[model samples]
Target chain A: MLIYDLFKMALRSLIANTMRTFLTALGMIIGVASVISMISIGEGARQQTLSTISKFGTNIITVKPGRKKTRHVSSDSVQTLLLSDADAIEEHVSLIIGAAAQVYRPAQLKFGNKNTNTTVRGTGRKYAKLANFTLDSGRYFTKEEIISARRVAVIGATVVKNLFPDINPIGQELKVDGNNYLVIGITEAKGALSWYDPDDQIFIPVTTAQKRLFGMSYVQSIDIQADKIEDLEQIKKEIDTFLRIRHGIREGEESDFHVQNSSQWLNSWGDAAKTFTYLLGGIAGISLLVGGIGIMNIMLVSITERTREIGIRIAIGAKKSEIMEQFLIESVLISFIGGGIGIMLGILISRTVSEIGGWETIVSTQSILLAFGFSVAVGIFFGFYPARKAANLNPIDALRYE
Target chain B: MGQLYLNLSSESVMIEVKELSKTYQLGKVDVHAMVDVTFRIDAGEFVAVMGPSGSGKSTLMNLLGCLDLPSSGSYFLEKFDIRSLSPNQLAEVRNKRIGFVFQNFNLLPRASALENVELPLLYGRIQNSHQIARDSLERVGLADRAMHRPNELSGGERQRVAIARAIVNNPAIVLADEPTGNLDTRTGDEIMNVFSSLNDEGATIILVTHERDVASRARRIIQMKDGRMHQDILNEGLIA
Candidate 1:
């Protein structure tokens, strides 16, 4: 028989039972839709993460103090880091662009009747440049303020909103730890970074916060920047050696601090996001498998129902290959129609999610094609056994079938 | 009476069977359905094979229709040796040159009269089947009911439609196995009239039945008993 005739016969058979055909195709529709939507959402999230990581300065490195175990716990333990270490690294590290020591502590800021708890970080003038901090109002604390340990402070956007929502916050007096300090600047509205809200902190000169608020002289950690992004590793090595020498740690003794580069954090976070996307997509893939099985079951039932018809066709001189082709065409048609509907539904669902939940979603042509191709393959793979059974039927027995 | 002799040189013989026998294997035992059957049918002849139930009349028809192979002996259809033909070749011969009408009027239940008539032609390599199918239905007096499916038609009407389907391709032979078996006497007579008219138009026909009234309609009757041919007789001037 001609291919056109086979297609027409298949189409007519499918249309003769509209409800059954529709129900059979429904599985493929849901399967393709879920697969497309999940993959698109994963792609969108991956792009978002990459863009967010790029916002941070690529050449930045951070050195944090590891927890120290002392022989005896005492209030007068010797400090492992100081302001001199920051100054020494700036002079000795040739690849270093700039460096600053930061001392961080949690404190409550009181302005009039309102009060808000926020982290206060004390650092030198170069800290703002190294960390990509931008001021939204007034100016950062001057170098003169750090040398004199003057009680000047710069608040983040969230601190400005909480403590001085109705009034201008710059140059306003706010009490911190029972000491009064003037807010010299407010940082720009930068969203969350590394799960920490950059908008909920206050910045002050390192010497002032150490002497007046925390009552300590040692800095907590040092932040560094490289002149070239490629020089970050060399710069980190220099800072590590300088810190170890300054803290008087000898060879074979573990250093009290560790240095980390921004790329390391970026890689770890990228890996985590990839795993999360795979896990989510894997869960969604189960639905597609179920859908494929449903298609197979329906096709098998169709073969059984049309057994006599198959017999008649065979008796009327239809070749086995022709019989197989007809059934295969019908199966593929069902899945193709289902895949088309699924693509439309997936697009609608993706748009709805983006609009309602404020989620980032990207629907690509590759995703649509991939989904359609997979459904077609599933149709053939799952439809094969039923088609073969129909083709191989005994004409005499089939014609005798009531 | 004239003695029938084998004509070795006659190319006009439509069917020739010699010492044909068939035994169906029913599990461990073989049931002999037909034994040493010899017959010949010419083109455009109207003949009937008559027998009681289990007398092997249907088995003979099946052999003549090329639906089953003989366990022994030779059968030739239109000069083609049927015993040597494959199953697919038999199906092709059935499609192109033979039409079958079953006792139950085995018209496809879901298809319209026109579609059912077009079925045999669909398998043939004919491109103008629609017009042929319509003409065949018209010949069977079913043109008005061409669009009606089998379930919507009466027994006689369904038989006429099956007749239309059988003849749509202009086959060499039309085989009716108790074509009016399920119809009332009057309806059965009507169906027989259609078959007689078709045979008059130069189509060979073979009717298989146990009913004397039905067998009397044919120009010649061949009787069978216990898987063997008992008699072959011609009617001189009988009105069926």
Candidate 2:
């Protein structure tokens, strides 16, 4: 028989029972829609994370003091990083743009009667450039202030809002640990960095903080900036070697400090996001397999129902290939129609989720095409057995079927 | 008796059967449906096989129509040996040469009268199927009811649609198995009248019936019993 005639027959048979056809197609529709929507959400989240990481300075590196162990079996080791180590790194590393040593402590800031407990950071002027900090008002302390150990401070926007609400905070006097200090600047409102709220802290000179509040000459960590991102590894090695020599570490012993680049942290985050998305897509793909099985079941029932019709066509001279082709075409048409509907529904679902859940969603053209092609493949793969069964039926016995 | 020719000439028989038998394996037992049945039917002969239930009349018709294979036989249809043809080749022979009319009319319920008549032509390699199907329906006096489905037509009208479908491909023979078994006596008579006109136009026809009046419509009657032929009689007088 001609292909057109077979197609016409298939279409007529499907149209004769519209409700059953629609119900069968609905399974595939839901399967494709869920897969597309979940993948879109995952892709959107991954892109957002990468963009956020890139916004931070890519050439920045941080060094922290490692836990010290006592050689003489003492319970505690008093080994601490100091300002001299920061000086050593600045003098020795060729690729280092600037370095700043920091000492952090919690203190209460009192301006007149209003007081708020906030974290205090003690560092030099170079700390502002290394950490990508910008001032919104006034200016940071000059080199003269650091050398003289002047009691000058730079407040964050959140600290100014809480302690000096309605008052100009620049050049105002604020008491810290019972000592009076003048606030010289206010930093810009920078949102959370690494889960720490950068907008709620105060900055002061490391020399003055160590002399007055901390009463120690030691620092907790050092921040460094590289002139070019490509020189970051060389700069870290130079700093490690300088620190090891300054602390008198032997060749075969582990160092008491660790150097970490921003790229390492970003890589960890990116890897976690990729795994999450793959897991989501894998779970959704199982539903697609189930949907394909549903299609196969319905097609088997259809073949059984039309056994006599198949016999009549075969008796009238239809070839086996022609019979197979007719059934294959019917299955493909069903899945194609279902896939088209699924794409429309998936887009709508993604939009709804983005609006309601406040999650970012991006639907790519490639994903839509991939989903449609997969649905077609599923139809052919799952529809093959039933089509073969229909094609191989004996005409004499089929005609005699009740 | 007519002279039977062995060569493929004008005088050769269109269908020749010799010692044809069919046995069905019913579970563990084998039932002989047609035992050593022999017959020859020439072109343009209106013949009937008459018998009671379980008398192998339908079995004989099935073998003649190429719908079933015989257990042991040498049956020649035209010039080809029926036993030697494959299933697909047999289907082709049935499509191009033989037309069948079943007792229940066997009209596809979902199709219109015109589409039903167009079915056999669709199976054939014929162009202009619509025109030929319309002409066949006109021949059966159902031109006005061409668009009505089987359920919408009366019993006499449905039987006429079946006749139209049977002759639509212009096959060499028309085989009817109890063509009027489900219809009333009057409708059955009307269907027989349609067969009479079709045979008058030189189409060979074979019918299976148990009624004496129905068998008398044919020019020859072969009576069967216990899977074997009992008598062969000629009707010297034709029914009007």
lDDT of 2 at B64: 85
Worst 10 residues of 1 chain B by lDDT: B1-10
User: What DockQ does each prediction reach against the true complex?
Assistant: 0.32, 0.37
* Candidates' chain B TM-scores in the order shown: 0.94, 0.94
True contacts kept of each: 0.26, 0.36
Residue range A196-285, candidate 1, lDDT tens digits = 787899999999988888988788888888999888887788777777777777876677777888878787878887777666667666
Please provide, for model 1 over B45-80, each residue's C-alpha lDDT reduced to its tens digit, 9 standing for 90 to 100: 899999898889988987887767899988877877
Superposed by TM-score, candidate 2 places the C-alpha of residue A206 at a distance from the truth, in angstroms, of 5.9
lDDT for A239 in candidate 2 is 82
Put down candidate 2 lDDT per residue, A319-344, tens digits, no spaces. 67777888987887778777889889
| lDDT for each candidate structure | 0.83, 0.83
lDDT of 1: 0.83
* Cα error, candidate 2, residue A260 (Å): 3.3
Per-candidate TM-score against the hidden true structure: 0.83, 0.80
What range of 10 consecutive residues in model 1 chain A has the weakest lDDT sum? A69-78
